[model samples]
Target: MTRTYRIAAIPGDGIGAEVVGAGQKVLQALAKLDGGFTLDITGFDWGSERYRRTGAFMPGEGTDVLRSFDAILFGAVGAPDLPDHLSLWGLRLQICQTLDQYANVRPARMLPGITSPLRNVEAGDLDWVIVRENSEGEYSGQGGRSHRGLGCEVATEVSIFTRVGIERIMRFAFELARSRPRKRLTVVTKSNAQRHGMVLWDEIASEIASEFPDVVWDRMLVDAMTVRMTMDPGSLDVIVATNLHADILSDLAAALSGSIGLAPTANLNPERSAPSMFEPIHGSAFDITGKGTANPIATFWSAAMMLEHLGETAAAERLMRAIERVTADAENHSPDLGGSATTEEITSATIRAIGLNAT
Candidate 1:
């Protein structure tokens, strides 16, 4: 009675293929080691290269094709020659919005061997899981440009905030906060300026906070929140923000921890009606495309998150322990982490580390 989990792997563009390959290899090793379950992974050649060939990143049937899988392991998106918005909308956003994968979860922490850019921060000083409202908010894709090339051309990209969307994500964030040891959550908003939607976010957060008296929570302006993230990293536990703000903050969190190469994100539906997509937040770096210097840690971490989402908690923990083992050695650091190890080199080390564990 071995459990078989179907996974969709999308190595979107540039170094995407390299890191995704690394993740698949390590995951294969884990599957072989565990022997209790199986990963039936399907790889899709849908990305910038495909866009260049067909004017679309994925086909019309791509979303429906992915519905049967248990989870998705995404590499990266963005291409040197293709427009970022096109690549984003065509593939990633299409899958997310279509499937209602509305909760974007990004966890950042200082791994053992990595040195933080923050002056005195260490491992425990910066551990934060940012829960972003994924489906709507600034990224709701609601506006358009009226005049293409006119000097007085008008354009508007609307930010949508529904009470339904806000409440669900806030409740999700509070539950996540309750699960963490600190039992603290910060609701990020720009209510003072954007009084309408953002104010609703504040009201809903307060309403949600009342439901969880055991959980300590507060609201912060997005601007001041950024300063707090840097200056007082330890004080924060779990953070919940709108789409655009969390997008910016998570990148900064990655840099402060060590590198964007170490950041992983999970776009979840939470209801489990649709397959969740897990990916590294780092965009494609064409400069490192063929050089093998792309760090695979983020992809590996993303794979670990996917494993956890699939109820393979044991295997997921095993994968993360292996990652920490590799990151604990500076000699295993990729170029992004200021060492010269190639992607394959680091992957090999991670696989070997995975083999060392008894479980």
Candidate 2:
């Protein structure tokens, strides 16, 4: 029997729509080439524009609607006019936190054709996967303001860390490290200053370290981790950090690898209790919203992650190979990578490569 996977596509805002359009074409090409499975993608017009129209990014039943799909392919989020937090909390966070997608996985590496900013880094040297605690931490939304317009105004933003939350994420990070060839994991924390929650993060990570004896693990303060990431890129393999730290570090990782436009994110629920989400790490670039010059490789890479999450391993690897093949050629590069090719040209090249490609 042929396998059919239901996919939800949320082309959230700005270049999100552009890259998502590219993602759909690449996915269609991949399914056609694989011949073993097919995709049924449902597109939703839920984004900043929709928020402007109805005062909400999506319908009240949005989470209910997403539950039926096997996986979600998300485009970028945010807009020039909307408050960043509102756009984030309104859509992306709503889906992620609601579905309990507690593990945010981001992979950063030197693509074959791209040149790294690091002086002497090679493909294998700078390759790393960053696992972030997705559900809670600084972003748990536990704080509020006290005064309205008084001089003694008080505002507090709380970071919540529970034993259950810390333990699960640490275990997930360790298992991910064990799967990689190097079997090395770097746990990031700010335990020295933020003694409460960050300390809990450290304790749980150490406790989980005992469970994966084969994996070589170490800890780095969030500040020092940045230096280590740039100065000693090769020394790190898999990194685990809190939501805030990982968010910053991953952006730096993307820049070191090549371009921020090349990074992909997987918001995963390992237990498979709900559909996971895959998206590019790049945000909505309002400057290039309709320019047709945005890079589609990140979206393509996210699509590959979506396929892998859906158990279409062969298709996932094939899609990645095709992405690497196209990215390796600078002539087909988008403006972000310092080439002039349009989104259509690069996407077309990727789809063509998929047909001509083999495992």
Candidate 3:
């Protein structure tokens, strides 16, 4: 029997639309190759443009609309004209919080034929999966402002941490680490400076560490951890951090591997309760909005992750092999990966690598 998975594609803002289109093309090609399952993609036009037109980034019933889908393939989300916070909180974070997507998993590894900025780093040397506490912590939206536009304006963006939130994410990270080959985990926090929330993270992490005896774990302050990632990336394996810290570190992780264009993130619910969201770690590049230069590998990789989450593991592995085949050829790569191929060229090459003609 052929299984059909419903996918909600939200190509929010700028280069998002372009990359999402590319991901859909690759998935379609994959479906053509393997007749075991099918993908039904429904695109949502909800972003800065929609906000400009309708005064809301997404409809008020957005969560209700998205709940039916098996998974979500997201493109980058940002705009030059709109405030970053408005677009972010209005869409991405809203979905994550509402759906209880607590695990933001980002994989940073040097793909085959891609050069790392770090010296003498091989393909297997700098592979790490960063697990971010997605639904809460610093991004819990527990802050306020007083006396705006005045000499004494005070703004407070409170970082909220709950026992439930901390423990679950810690256990998730530990389980992930235990599943991997190295069975190692790095917990990042600024507990020295942040005595309350970060300290609590450390405490919970320590408590959870005992449960996963097979997995070796360590803690690092967020600042020093940055240096460690750059200087000694090979030493790390699975990294777990707060929402804000992981957000910053993952971008650095992406860049260190080669380009932000090569990294994919999964905003996962992990309990099969609601739809998980997958997207490129890189943000919407306004500079490359209309240009055909935006690299589509990240989105392609993201699509693969979505497939794996949907339980189409064979299809996901095949799709990844297709991407690797395309990326291995210098002539088929994008400018970000030190080649000059356009997005369309990369997409077509990937399709060809999948043993199909782009239709």
Q: Cα lDDT of model 2 overall?
A: 0.94
Ranking by TM-score: 2, 1, 3
Please, what are the lDDT tens digits per residue for candidate 2 over residues 250-277?
A: 9999999999999999999999999999
Tens-place lDDT per residue, model 1, 228-265, is: 98999999989999999999999999998999999999
- Tens-place lDDT digits, model 3, residues 1-359: 99999999999988999999999998998997888899999999988899999999999999999999999999877898889999999999999999989999999888878888899877777999999999889899998999999999999999999999999999999999999999999999999999998889999999999999999989999999999998888789999999999999999999998899999989999997999999987789989888898999999999999988888898888888888888778998787887899999999988888773222
Estimate the TM-score for candidate 2: 0.99
- List the candidate 3 regions with Cα displacement exceeding 4 Å: 356-359
- The all-Cα superposition gives candidate 2 an RMSD in Å to the true structure of 0.8
Pairs with steric clashes in candidate 3: none
Lowest summed lDDT across 10 adjacent residues in model 1 is found at 350-359
lDDT of each: 0.92, 0.94, 0.91
- For each of the candidates, the C-alpha root-mean-square deviation to the true structure, in angstroms, is 0.9, 0.8, 1.8
Number of clashes found in candidate 1: 0
Instruction: Give the range where candidate 3 is weakest over 10 consecutive residues by summed lDDT.
Output: 350-359
TM-score against truth, every candidate: 0.98, 0.99, 0.98
Task: Flag regions of model 2 displaced more than 4 Å.
Answer: none
Top candidate on lDDT is 2
